[model samples]
Target: MDLTVIWAFIIAFAVFAYVVMDGFDLGIGILFPTFAAGRERDRAMNSIAPVWDGNETWLVLGGGGLFAAFPLAYAVILPATYPLIIAMLLGLVFRGVAFEYRWRDPAHQKFWDMAFTGGSFVAALAQGMTLGALLQGIEVEGRAYAGSWWDWLTPYTLLTGLGTVAGYALLGSTWLIWKLDGEEQAHARKLAIRWGAATIVLMGAVSLYNISLNADYAARWLTAPEIYWVAPVPILTGIVAISMLRAILKERNSKPFWLGIALFFLGMSGLGVTIWPYAVPEALTIWDAAAPERSQIFMLVGVALTLPLIIGYTAWAYWVFRGKVADEGYH
Candidate 1:
């Protein structure tokens, strides 16, 4: 395989890793405003505190990989989706501040709590809008953005934005159910069921909107030979979603979190299959948007050297932090 092709997939994997790692934590934040106003919230925060910073490293990996390995696509897509991207960055900043300061200024905990929840909401929403805009297809002329600033907003994209929030909440809820005990755990279980149902409906809405948004949806999804390759996506997604629901119903702890992760991975895989080879989907092929071969090779070598350390430390941290969180919150 060509090195560039390998790099493209590598970048995709990094992005997926970010979503999977940071995703549940973001979900936790999304679920913060629920029955967690007191000790429950503290327990929830403790559940993720050890691993949250580490989880976001994958975002750096993905973004840095894109800039280094596919500068052209980065230049185009970033500029086109600048507003939402900025919103995402700002939200990240906001949440990070809230995380630390809430502990420091206990008197202002309420303000910080709202900040944390609001930040997560904005970040997740912006991410979904970016995905929707990308999938909806960027208008490029001469490989440059051809649309207005708000081109990222559309009825379909907004629906996807909401879906993303629900998805993260589900992820968070399941994680809470897994890592918490007693009242906190039970509360998370209830939210998991609610968010799980919302996820299904939103996913359906996204699927339905895809048909109207894409002229080729019928050919690509309904009758294309490629459909055979992707047929397992919906089937497996349904399986995980059902399994997640089942785990919650059975009052199982650990299984629900893993099932939620499976559901997310399956959804991401489906999207990847739908948009393979085309980094910009219908506009720029990976090869076209890739950096010069020398640059790609250099970065590939760097990633190869660095990724194992990342994987190892990630494993170590999770191990060190393993076991259930107590409702005492962060001390």
Candidate 2:
């Protein structure tokens, strides 16, 4: 068996889980300013309060798995995108602090709310830019990053950053539509339509820009034989996009959120199609960067034991917290 390939899938699953689970809350933070103060804002916050911290577990798993199973990829990728990584981490930290203190320090809740919005925006933008930096291909020299400090700060990266922000905002809006009712839900539906349209446009822009970054990327999606395999991703994405809009317009609450998830899943699938086997784009294949077999087998054992437990608890938590958020909230 190819342990490296197995580990790569596990890591990819973890990252995708992180993006879907945490993306909505970060999106909420991005759209916080638009929410009416007091009840509306509080309900929006409460919708995610139960699961926000728990959602980050996947991020820890993804990053840790990378360090353990693909040390060379981690080592090279980190230096190549350190600035964006640092920004993302700091944003998460500040966002967490704001989430906690906003309630505790009600007198200064405004400040905390602003902090939350800013932090979420920065984190989402940095994450998208990090993906862009990778897609554009990292500068590597014999397993080490050979890029300049500002290599990640380009127009393409900025476009991707904005796209991610828009995508997350869509997630947030759809989540709100599902979890809130009355005026807030109506407002969220409006926001969802706007953000959804923006996300689709930006998704298209990013795709077009992505192909321009490398001939291989263009060939993978547009060339014959490969195109047959790749066609389903975008085709499904269009179908889901239409379904999501219909669900939102029809006021189907939960359907929109689920369809939004489908959109993200399809987006991730497209990304996988674009960069399979390669751990660092054209620079390093999974085999080139993976750790020894014994280490992987050991890690796989632990993952097998713990992964089920993580999924069980996460599912249970969401199930327990299901239904419309209360005005009083869990806090």
Candidate 3:
């Protein structure tokens, strides 16, 4: 395989992992309020407390990989989307602090709860907006961003922000059903159905928007004769979505979260198929943005050795913490 392609897939996998893992926890925060208070809310927080930080490591890995493997793309895209990224980070800061402080001081619990939920919503929305802007296509000329800073605020991108909020809420709802019991689980089931339905609509709207705006992307992804032979990801996405919905309706506990991961993966896979070689869609190809071969070889070695360790530790942690969350959480 081409080294550039290999690097792209590596970064893509890290991102996919982050979106699926951290995505659920983030969703939990998104769905945290709606009738969740006191012990129930604490249980919701506890369910993700064990793995949330570790899950965020995947986001770091993805960004670092891009910076290392595709410096030019990182350099350009960052400046183009600096505000959204900063806002996302700020949201993350609130979330990370809320995780620790909420446990430390029960008297001020409501403040921390607000911070957590608001942070999750902001972070999810910001990230969604980033994806939206990317799909809308960045403006790059001579390997530099040439677009207005406001370019990220298009109508399509705004809808994407809303879509992701719904999507993440659905994921969180399923997780609650898995980790909690009785009434909490039932509330989550209802939330899942509502958010799941919204997500389906928003996804359709986004696809229609994508086709309406980016003719070339649409042709490559859906309309062209070769699309049948190219990527089956979008089709698989429907199956995952249906499976998750069914799992929720059937009250299948753990199945809902796993199916949520599958749904997120299939969606990311569809996006990947649409923007393969382009590190910064419509801006730079992976080849155009890659670092020197020596850097690639060195980093590839480091990545190969480290990934298994990350995976192992992550698996071990989850195994140790398996089963329903209780009042104590991990502490």
Error of 2 at 141 (Å): 0.7
Clashing pairs in 2: none
Clashes of each: 0, 0, 0
The residue-by-residue lDDT of candidate 2 on 220-269, one tens digit each, is: 99999999989999999999999999999999979999999899999988
lDDT for predicted candidate 2 compared with the true structure: 0.94
Question: What lDDT score belongs to each candidate, Candidate 1 first?
Answer: 0.86, 0.94, 0.86
The residue-level lDDT of candidate 1 at 223 comes to 69
Q: Model 1, 40-110: lDDT tens per residue?
A: 78889999988998999999999988988888889889988999999999988888899999999999999
> Which ranges of candidate 1 are over 4 A from the true structure?
327-329
Worst lDDT run of 10 residues, candidate 3, spans 223-232
Ranking 1 against 2 by lDDT, winner: 2
Best by lDDT: 2
Q: Which stretches of candidate 3 lie over 4 Å from their true place?
A: none
